[model samples]
Target: MDVIKGLLVLACAWGFSAHSAVNMQQEAKNISDLSQSMTGSKEALNTNVISPLSGGGSLKTFDRKEDFSFSIGTCSASEVFLKILTQPQSSGRLRLLAIEQDTSLDGNLDKFINVNMDADMVCSNGIMQCTNVDDFSTCSSFKWSAASDRTVGLTRVGMSELGGCYCISGKCGNALAWRNLKQVLTDVAGGISASLAAVNPYYTMSGVTVEGTQATVTGGNAQCATGSVTDLVSTTDPKKLASYQNDPNKMKQDSQTETASSWAYQAIQSGSLNPQESSEIRRCSEVRQPIIDSAKLSDIITLDSGTGGVGYCGADCIMLTLGTVGDNYWNSPCGEFGAAARFFIKDYKRIKSAVLEKAIFDDWIQILLNGNYIWSGPYNNWTGQAIPGQCELSTSWNINPNVSFKHLFNKNGVAEFKMRVMVADAGEGYAFARLTADLSCKDTKTDTIANSCSVYQNDPECTLLEERVDGVLTFSSGAITGLNPLPQSKTISQDSCQITIQRPWFNKNRTYRCNVKTQSDLTKAIARSEKIKTSTTAKDYQDIQFKNGGIVGDSGTLNFDNLPTVQPCVQACKVRKPVYPDVALDGVDKGVVNPTHYDVTYKECSVGVCPLSSGEELVQACQCTNDFAEATAIMQIMRNAGQDMICSTGIEKPL
Candidate 1:
């Protein structure tokens, strides 16, 4: 064998071994451990809690001023607003707020402390400890220490010192924890802290914008003005700054600044913006950023590279093998290709009506069979040859002319193939088959079939029960009309079963059923070979919920059943008129449009918040504020931050 072939063989072996060794418990623990400290040592900032995968035994701690610089970055404003979700793993009083350049909190003991913590401690033996950790009324402190020199000469009292704006206490227990915090803090702050935008004057705009610019904040009352500060260097990584995954259904876009600012607002207002909480938020942000970014890619291009499994055959890599449809003798043949058979053939009646339309399907199948693709299996050549019982070829279709599959992947430990082909004897002139041995499913509790038949195969259901009885005789009137063949089944592991549809369009129709099944359930099988988009996590759903104003109901209610009014802020901000070629539709050139020559009766300026229910209707009788653009952008940020807005007054007016 050639050197390339030899290398491929070795790589495939290692991949299989690695995959076989993956422990689900370890994976969950890895994520869970990120939020809590495992080290038995005292809570000091800057302690590195290395994960087991990194070969470290120490528990990771939050960064401190000793180890990191606490100064905000060049993107910071005079005041920064933040919110924090408190987890109850190891509840303790947040000590110093170290303005660190990095996360190491050693020796930078003169950091900003909770005003309450600072007051309660009384400096016994140079050690500060909380006298009453539960009484957080005095904890609200967003002040720079006098030692820091920023406020040395200023006589202004901090917002926390003012009456009415009290500190937030304890962990929030709302199922929609993010939403509840808004009310909890508002009531706790006595409406003094309505939102982060309202409270924090030194809000940083770093890594918040699509382009990392501070959004224009025009005429809103400054709740706690910290005065202007030049661009400071943020100690934390921008990627791990905040949870940016907002509900696309509610928020206009993923504004990172809004998320970061909102979180900071909550933290400061709630008096939870300390070293420990900051570090935890950073960790959670790091864990969640990739998942959110992946979900945003327009076409899941990373997974669906538009190539097939044959790419593995790269002339030198011949250890990989592919198989044809109906090859029952091909035992676990490394990799195989399959698709819904309906793709290849056309019914006579539909064909005669739209031969041109059916031709598109033929083109797609031709690309699949002719495309240079590789199978997803071990890179170490677990199996040899390009196709079973055939010589290695870049085009697998050259070896087996009449078969095609959408993608190739391993099912269980065995290579399961899906075939889409035009069969002369089949009634629909097409046949779809799942050509993989049915290894006895040991744990039916965790095993689930993809049930793709409802959408792709045009069957009532795709069930193993039907698969078992496919050829069984069905006598409906003591006469045999035809056999009821079982539809194809895509087995979904228990891990992939956590959902109700995400991404609104995924629930719209069956346009991408086959791809969704392959990506979600058969992720591991195809991930190495293809860019399979992973499923969203429970945290993703919460982040999305919080982005979309967080499922509001009657205050203090347990359920999200009673939703708030769907205010179409986008509609409220749009300018309604007829079309004009050279004129901008945003309340400008309204009188310039030729009414008689308009394509649509009412030309809509799709600018602001449009309710999902109204579709495209223009919000009637709402007026724009003087700072409409700024208000619109800020409102989008606030709405994305889960702040409830009463939009009956239009974009300019804030309720």
Candidate 2:
């Protein structure tokens, strides 16, 4: 390689310095003349030719140990430079043998001839070098001596300069090696075609294109150029790219479907069409409800009675004094027990806002709607026991309309207002409460009508006469005209002229009738008297006729049926039942802490749809479970203390 480089540098220097003044056109003509003399042809030699294998211009190759020789001129002083340009089209190094001559006449080389080999030559001082091969900026010169005969030899070998693999016959660098290896492996394996069949497609080069210095090979199903052996191995097989065995999207879809199917199956097994209410006993219980601030309250109404023998005494005065009373304090019939008094607000839909104006009680009194706690006060401590020496206690609270109506009112628009009084050691039991609210109602109406018509015509005229009648019919009341009457004519020779008007009526439930006026014109009448016949018929109007505007009909009554009045509360509550879950305690053990002591359990009777004030056999009203109630109370306390907590269904926070 070093020797080749030194010789290339020397040849380039000699080419530029020796032929710096040579005429390019004259040299080309001389070469053409020499070529014609040697081949005995008139045409010029086409030196600018591209090789099929190398895809480069003026490419020539020779095998190793082959004798190669080319002659330019026969011992001429006027030297001609036979410029040859060589470029390797594949992965290999190019080699050129220096020209030699046998001047001693002993069949041995004695002198070397200088030849120009560069496409572009630059000269500085006395040295010449090739700057770029593609730029043909200067022509090269070849010097021939009369003392020696010129000879040239070129050799090309399939070997890469980068020391990996070399391309052969315009093929990819490793293609031939891969083929030979595959054949050897096939022979060793007793010609098992299946072992190499999968890899055979990738090794086959479909085609190659050489553009300038770059060579692109299309292989591996001929879709794209396989840049390297690694690329071919990675991209050829589609099975290695993807698999559906652990797709997360498919797994998630399957899990959701299974959950829905399980819920549906459970609903079916429990004999309930709705999955949420399946195998669950529903009863009225205290549950938190969100308040809507947009609803305004007006038209205040006061209640006078409540359950558990509690009644209104007067303004701001309510008492549960059914058993015995002393010193303005009522005693419970049972000692050391709890008594509950409930006030039902049946007009819950119309009532927008409710407020407990005042509540006076001895012992401990807790006011609630359904099961939601409204107010509890004057307790001895956090245990909710009655405070000693506190015989009379009073506290007022405002009720949230949304919370009150959601749990208290069933689908039938009835609400239960309750208050529980606990007496410890049977001292005294007193309950006094007052509630005021607002109610509203609205009404609507509609009407419809159907009308039809029938007409009878009679005409008496026995003459050759032509009669034409024309007029417009008008209605008295605002009624939609079904059809209008058109003009009619007839020619009566011997019989009477008769005209019938039918299928004309109005379409509203109103006292109205169509009045018709006819003006008969006689044309070409000869001894004839034509009597035209016409009549009007309607549902609630007397039939009449006139020549001009006048009273031509009698009025009758048109009755309209009114639709039932719609209460605003009913419309609001109807859509509420399907979405809201039934207000019921979860279970005895899960909801209430001490069920035996409090005498509270999950109600087994029907809920929302049950009738009001019925016995326990039909429907039962109950309080919310202790755990949920306590959780709500604690959350409320935390919010009041500026540490707000998020409240959700079926979620309990430790107090």
| TM-score versus the correct structure, for each prediction | 0.14, 0.19
Q: What ranges in model 2 sit over 4 Å off?
A: 1-335, 342-344, 379-418, 422-427, 430-441, 445-655
Kindly report which residue stretches of model 1 are placed more than 4 angstroms away from their true locations once superposed.
1-310, 313-400, 404-411, 414-655
Q: Please write out the lDDT profile of model 1 over residues 538-576, one tens digit for every residue.
A: 121110112263433211111222223343532333333
lDDT values, one for every candidate: 0.26, 0.30
Clash counts for the predictions, in order: 67, 3
Best by lDDT: 2
Q: For model 1, what is the error of residue 644's alpha carbon versus the real structure, in angstroms, after optimal superposition?
A: 69
Cα RMSDs, all models = 39.6, 57.4
**What is the Cα-based TM-score of model 1?**
0.14
